[model samples]
Target chain A: MRYLTHKLIAFLIALMLAPVMLAPSWAQTPTLNIDVNVGIREPVPFAVPIFIAENNGAQAVATEISRVIASDLISTGLFREIPAAAHISGVSDFNAPVQFADWRAINAQALIIGAVSTSGGQLTVKFRLFDVFAQAPMGDGIQFTGTEEGWRRIAHKVADTVYSRLTGEAGYFDSKVVFVSETGPKGDRRKRLAVMDHDGASLSFLTEDNAIVQSPRFSPNNREILYTSYESGQPRVVLMDIFTLQKRDFGDLQGMSFAPRFSPDGTRVVLSISNGSNTDIYAIDLRSGARTQLTSGPAIDTAPSFSPDGTQIVFESDRSGSQQIYVMSANGGEAKRISFGDGRYGTPVWSPRGDMIAFTKILGGQFHIGIMRTDGSNEKLLTRSFLDEGPTWSPNGRVLMFFRETPGADGAPQIYAVDISGRNLRMVNTPSFASDPAWSGLLQ
Target chain B: MRQLSKAAALAALLITAACSNTGGLFGGNGDGTDVNGLNGGPIDESSIAYFQQTIGDTVLFQVDQHTLTPEAIAILNQQAAWLNANPTATVLIEGHADEQGTRDYNTALGGRRANAVSAYLVSQGVADNRIQIISYGKERPLAVCSSETCWSQNRRAVTIVTSGPGV
Candidate 1:
C-alpha cells in the first residue's frame, strides 16, 4: 500500500537468527488468554533489561526502544513490568545465557532480552523471549534491520513479537491510529485530520485546520485514509494518500459523502452519501471510480463498516425508528437488524476477528461503548459516560478506542481506550482534543 | 489551532440567541454606535443584519427530530418573505445539531433539518436557485453548555444572506 511518493527510508528485514522461532507455538504459553476473566487474575510479572548496543549511536535508542517495549506490555494491564532496579542481573551481551535463578528471585515470570546495532544508516534490532518460571527460552530469537528513524517502529515490532508470543494472539503495538484533532472553544472549533502511533507516539498532522474533519478510517493496508472534510464548504468524502498527504474527492461529488470505510480487499470503499436530505450507504470501486448505492430508503444511514471477510457489512441506521445496528451482505440487500433492546446503537464496527461488533449505545441519556455478537446477542456495555461514541477495534480485536466529550464551555472531546471486558479504561494522549478515533491494522 | 469560519463571521447576528448574551443589545455594547443616528449595513430592513435580527434567520428543531415544528415553519415563512423582497440576496442555510447524539447520525439529521427548511422556503415562493445548504451536524455548537438549555439553541438551521449567486 506504500505509494511511490512515500519514500520510506526504513526497511525492516526480519532475520531469523534463531530458526526455531519460525513456527509460533501456541501450546508453550497457556497463562495469557484475553477470554479469561481478567478481573480475578493477577498480572504476569515480566522484565526487560536495557538492550545491548552493538555500535556507537545505538546506545540511546536501544534504551529507549526497550523502555517502549516495556511500556507497551505494561499498558495492556495483563502484564506487569518488574522495574530494572528489581533485577538481580543485567544482560550486557545478546548471546549470554539467561540466569533464570536471578530473575526468579525477583518474581519475574517473563524476561525480554534484546540487542541493537547501527551500520551504514541501517538500524538492526534483535530480541528473544524467555519464561523464567519454566527455566528456558520460550522461543528462538529474531532480529530486524531498518533505518535509524524507524527505531520506534522497530521497538513496537519487538513489543509485538513479545506480546504475541506470550498471549497467543497477534499484537497491536505496531499499528497506527487516525483521528480528528480539535482546538478552540465549542462555538468555533477547528478540527484537523491527524495520525499517530498506537501508543500516541510520533504524532503527525495530515491536514491544515482550516476545515472541519471527522471519522477518518484507515484502509486495510494502512497507506490511505478516508474521511469527511468540510474544506469544500460542504461535507464530502476524501481519499488521501497518507504518505503524500495528497487528497482527492471520492465517489460522485454531486451529493455529500461521509463516514467512509474500505473493504477488506481494499478494492472498494463503502460510505454514506447524502443528497441534502436522506443518507444511505454506497460502495465505490477504487480502480474504476464506479459507485453503487447499497441502501434505498428515507431512513438516515451513515456509519458503515466492512466485516473482515468482506462478505458482510454492518452499519447504523434509524430505519427502525431509532438508531440501531444492521447487517447485510456486502453486495447489499435486506439488512437484518442485529441490535435490539437498546436506547439506541450506532457506529457499529465489526471486529477484525469477525466474532463480535463494537458500537456506541445511548440509553437513559447516558452514552456507552458496547459490544455484541454478529448475530446481535450477548450485548455487553463496556464504558459509560456523559458521551461516548465511535468505537474502533484494535488490530487484535481485544480493545476499542473511542471519544468522550465533557460538559460546559471548557468541555472538549478526547480519545479513550477500553477493553472488551469493560476494564482498563485509559485516555490516549494527543496534542489537543481529539475524537472519532480509527485504529489501523498491524503495519507492514 | 484556533482558526475561525463563516459561522464566526455571523456572530454579530446571534445577539438574541437562547443560551448566551452578547453582553448587551446589538450596536449598543460595542462596534461603534452611529453618532449621526443613521447606521450602515446592519440596520436596513434589506440588510443582512436587519434580516438577521428582525426577520429572524434561524429556525430551531427538537431532539433527534428533523421534522420542522410549527415554530420552525413560522420562521421559514418569514425567511421566504425576506428572500422574495430582496431578490438579489441568496441564502446559505447552515444546519447544526447538539452534542447529545453521535457524530454521523447527527450530521445526517442536521442535513434533513436544513433541507426541510429549504423546502419550506421554496414552497413559499423563495426561488430554489437562491438557496444553498450545508450541514455542520454536531460539529459547530452555538452554545457551550451540555444541558438542554444550550442543546435547544444549538440544534438550529440559520439563513445567512449572501450576495449574487447561491453558495
Candidate 2:
C-alpha cells in the first residue's frame, strides 16, 4: 500500500513537469525559418495555363482572360509566364487541386489556375495561385463577377491579386492614364485630352482639338480631372468630370492660370497664374473660390505640386537667379530650397509614397527624367533625351511617365514610362504624337 | 527708241536713289518718295513692318541668360525709337527658350527674358503701358533644327505689335 502511494505522487509530479516542458520549450525552440532574403531581381518564373471554360460559349473569353493576365504580369518586369507548349500538365478542372510537381518539373516557381463561366450576360472569373516550390497554395482562391464588356478589367483584377500575393505590395494594373494626344507637325501641333487603360488599351479622347489643353492631373478620387485649357485665348484652369465629360471653369481670376493640380483632399486646386508681370503659385478653394497666393516674389514660381499629405508644396522657381526646386508649407510662407544639384530642376512631382520626388532635370544640353529623395539626396536619372519633361507618377509610386521629344523638325513627342528603380524603360504606344501623361488612382 | 530707253533709265535712277535713301533694299524706313499718301516730309516708317524688318523685332539671348548683350541692346535701341514714334501701338513681347531645358523652367526663363525686354523698352523711353509680355517658353520655335544655329534663333524675345498701325 505504501509503494502504491509513492507511485501516485510520482505520476502527479510527472504530469506537472510535462505541462511546463510543453509550454516553455516548444515556444522558445526555433523551427525551419525560411526567409526570402534575396530580392527577386530576376523575373519569377510563373505558369498561367489557359483557363478552363465551364461552358462551350465561354472558351474564347477564357483564352482572352488568361492572355491578358499573363501579359499584365509579364509587363511588370517581375514575372515571366511559361509557355503552354512547355507545360507538362494542363489545368482541366477549376475545382481540382494544382499539380505542383508538374509545375516544378517545368521550373515554374508560381502557378496560376483559373476558370471562366458565363450566364445571362454575366461573366465570372475564378482563380487560384500556388507556390509550386512550397507545394501548396499561397492564398485562398477568389472569384470575380462582371459584365461581358468588362472582361479586361476582370482579367486585370485577377492579375492584380496574383501580383500582390507574390510581391506583397499593391498592384497598379487596374489603373488608367490620362494624357495629351497630339497630331500634325511640330510647329502647328494639335493636342487633345485622351484617356486609356494603363496598358494603352481602350483609348478615347476626352476633349476635342478645338483648344490647346495641357498639364492634365487626376483628382485623388479619380472621378474628375484638373487641367489647363487655352479655350479663352489665355490659359485657364478647369475641372472636368471624367465620366460625364462635363466641365466647370475655375471662377474668373484676372490673370492666365496653368499647371493646375488638385489638393490631396480634392477640395482645392494649386496652380500658377501670371499676374501680367510675374507668375506665382496660388491655391483656390473649390467650393468657396477663395484664393490664397503661396508665393509672392518677382520671380516665376510655377508647377506647384502638393505633397501626399497636402501639408507641403514643391515647385520650381527662379528666385535664386536660376531655375531650382523649392518646398514650402501648403499655406503661404517662407519657402526652403530643396535642390542644390548641378542641373536645373522643374516639374517636381511628389511621389504618392511620400518618399521621393520625380522631376525633369536639364543639364549639359540634355534633358533627363530623374528622381530624388524628399530631402534632395540620392538623385538618380532614369532617361536622357533631347527633351523629356512633365513627369507624372504612377498610383503606387513605382513608375513614372513622361513625354520624350525627338531631335529635329519632325521630332514627335511620345509618352514613355520607367520604373523608379531605373529599369523597364518602355514607350507607351499612342496613335500619334502624345505627351503630358497623367496616371490616375485605382478605380473604386 | 533711244528716247524711250533714256526715259526708262531715268526712272530706274529715281527708284535706286529712293531705295538707298530709305536705308537699303530690305530697310525698315519707307522710301523717301511718299507714294502711299500722308502729308509726308520723310513719310514716317513707324509701321509694324518697319519695326520688324528694319528696327528688328527679336533679340536673341544666350542659353539660360536673360541679361541683354550689347548686340541685343543695339537692336532694342532702334525698337525703342520706333515705339516712341508711334504712341497708339501697344506691343506684346513674347519670350521663348531653346528646347534644352525643362518645360517649366524654360517657361520661367522665358518669362524673365520677356520681363527684361519690357523693362529695357521702358528704360529706352517706351511707355510701360504700351508693352505687355508673354512667355511661350519653348513651345514655339522659329528654327526647327537642333543645332546651335537653330537653338540661338529660338531663344529670343519677339516684340509683336498687337494693335495699332501693325494690326
Candidate 3:
C-alpha cells in the first residue's frame, strides 16, 4: 500500500506540471524575444552560421547563400543576428552533429546551418534549423537544386523556408527585381531596364542601349516586363518578353502613355495618357488591345496601381492643387483624395495584401519613402534621404526595394532595400548604377 | 552660289556696324550679336528669331500629359511639310516631361509624347522608318521653374535632324 501511494503521488506531481512543460520551446529568448503579434514584446535573437560546403563541393553556393540568408533575416528587424565570431563552436561539416551545449553557452536560443553540393550539372543545397533549448530541430531540413549561377536563389528559398517555419509568415527571399540601370552624366543620362535575382545576382538587360527605358515592372509571374521607353522616341508603355526580349507597344493612345503598372490579375495594365494636353488614367488590356478610361480630367492622373482585389486603384494626382495620392474604382469613377498630409506624394503603389499604399513623399525639401493605409491614414515614412523614391514591395509585403541617390563627389547612384518597419537598411551591391526597382512576386 | 557670296558680304558689314554701334541698342553688358542675355528673362525678339530658326514651331506639354493641341498639330503639319521637302534627312522626335512626377514616370511620359508625335508624323506621310522616337522625362527642361507655366513649356516633342549614321 505504501509503494502504490508513492507512485500515485509522483503521477499527480507530473500532471500538475504538464501544462507548463508543454509550452513552445521558442517562447523564451534570453538575448531577444519578438512577439510579432498585437501587443507583443521585443525582437527575437537568432544565430545563423555561414553554411559550410565541402572543399571541392558547393563552395560558391555555400558562401553566397549564407550571405543572402543573413541579409533577408536581418532586414526583417524582428530578429537579431548574433555575430559569427561570438559562436562557441564552428560548423565545419554539413551532416556533423550539432553540440547544443556549445550553442547554449553562446546564448543562442535558435541556430541555422546549411550544406551545398554540385553533381551532374545540378547544384543541391540542404539546410537545417535547431532550437537549442528544446534540443531538436525547430523544423525539418529543406533541400533545393538549381544552376551554379543561380545559387543565390537557392539560398533565398532556404531562407524563405526557415523564415516561414519560425514566424508563420511567407518569406520573400525567393524573388527577383526589375529596375532601371542608369549611366552617364545627369544631363544626358542613358537608362536601360535590367532584371536580377532579389539579392542582386544574374543581372541582365532587357532593352537596347540606344533608347532610354525606365520604371520596369514584372508581370505577376515575373516572365514579362511593362515599362516606359523612348525607343520609339516617345514615352509610351511597352511590354517586353523576358526570354526572347521581344517588345510591343501598349496601344495607339495617340498621346503620351506612362506610369504603367500591371493589374493584380496580370491581364491588364493601368497607365496615364496625355490626350489633347490633358493627362488621365487609362487601363489597357494586353490581350485584346481594348482600352478603358479610368480618370477623366486634367490633373496629371498618372501612376495608377490596382488594389489586391482588382476592384479599386490608388494613384497620384494634382487635382487637389498639389500632387497627392487618390483612390478610385478600377473602372474610372469619382476619386476621393486620400492625402491630407504636409507634403506632396506620388507613385502610390498598393500593397500586395490590399492594406497599405507605398509612395514617395516630398516635404520640407526632403524626399522620403512612406506608407499609409488605403484610406490614407496612419502614414509612416520608412526612409528619409537626399533623394529616395520608387518603392516596390517584396512578394510577402514585408519589405521594400528602392533606390537612393547621394550627390557624391563621384556622382554615383545606389540601390537599397529595407523592411517596412524602417530597419535593416542595407546597400545592394552592383557593378553599375541602379534605380527605379520593382520587386517581383515569389518564384515558383 | 551668287546668293551665298552676297550673304557672306552682308554678314561682314553687319558685324562691323554692330561693333561700332555697341552700348546703344546692344547695350552696356557687351551683349553684342550674341543673344546670351536672352537666356535670363522672357523671350526676346532676337531669341524668338533664334527659336524660330533652330527650335522651329514646337508644341509643349502640360506636366505628365502628352496630348497635342490644335496649335501643336498645325506646327507638326508645318514640320511634316518641311520633312517632306527634306526626304533625305531622318528626324528624331524627342519627348520631354516636366519635373512634377517621378523621374521614371516622367521618362515614360516623355517617351509617350515622343511616340505620339512619331505616330502623327507617320500619319502625315513621313515614312515610319524615317522618324525615331525618344523620351527624356523631366530630365532636360528648357525652363527651371516649379510653376504651371514652366511645366507647360517643359513638356514638348522637338524634331531633331539626324546627320547620317556615323556622323
Best candidate, lDDT: 1
Residue B140 CA displacement from its true place in model 1, Å: 0.7
Model 1 residue A278 lDDT score: 87
Interface RMSDs of the predictions, in order, are 3.1, 9.9, 8.4
- Every prediction's TM-score for the first chain? 0.93, 0.90, 0.86
| Stretches of candidate 2 exceeding 4 Å from the true structure | A1-39, B1-47, B123-130
- Using TM-score, rank the candidates from best to worst: 1, 2, 3
TM-score (all chains, Cα) for each model: 0.90, 0.84, 0.73
Better of 1 and 3 by DockQ: 1
Q: Report the lDDT tens digits of candidate 2 across residue range A1-444.
A: 234323322221221110011112212212212222233477888899999999988999999999989988888777778899999987899767677888899899888888888888778888877778777666677777766656777788888888777776677887889899999776657889988777887677778887778889999988789888767655688898766678999777876788889999999999988754588999999898899989997888999998999999999898998788888999979999989999788899999988898999988888899999888899989998888888888777887889999999888899998888778888888988898899988655
The digit string of per-residue lDDT tens for model 2 on B57-159 reads: 8899998888899999999999888888888888878788987876656666777788889999999998888987767677778788888989999999988
Candidate closest to the true structure, highest DockQ: 1
In candidate 3, stretches whose alpha carbon ends up further than 4 angstroms from where it belongs are A1-45, A50-55, A75-80, A83-85, A92-97, A407-412, B1-31, B34-101, B104-135, B141-167
Order the numbered candidates by lDDT, best leading: 1, 2, 3
Pairs in clash, predicted candidate 2: none
Model 3 Cα lDDT, one tens digit per residue, A1-444: 234323322221221110111113434333222343332245556788888775476776677778888777766666667888899898987677889899888777778887777775567777777877777776566677666655666677777876787777788877778888888765456777877767776666666566667788889877788988766545678988776667888656886677889988898998877742357888888788899998877566788889989999999887776778999989889999998999889889998978999999988767899899999899999998767888999888877888887643234467898777776688887768888899989876
Q: Put down candidate 1 lDDT per residue, A218-281, tens digits, no spaces.
A: 9888888999998877898999988767888863457677899999999999988887778999
- Model 3 residue A71 distance off true place after TM-score fit, in angstroms: 3.7
Error of 3 at A324 (Å): 1.8
Candidate order (DockQ):
1, 2, 3
Error of 1 at A422 (Å): 1.5
Cα distance off (Å), candidate 3, residue A260: 0.9
Per-model lDDT? 0.82, 0.79, 0.71
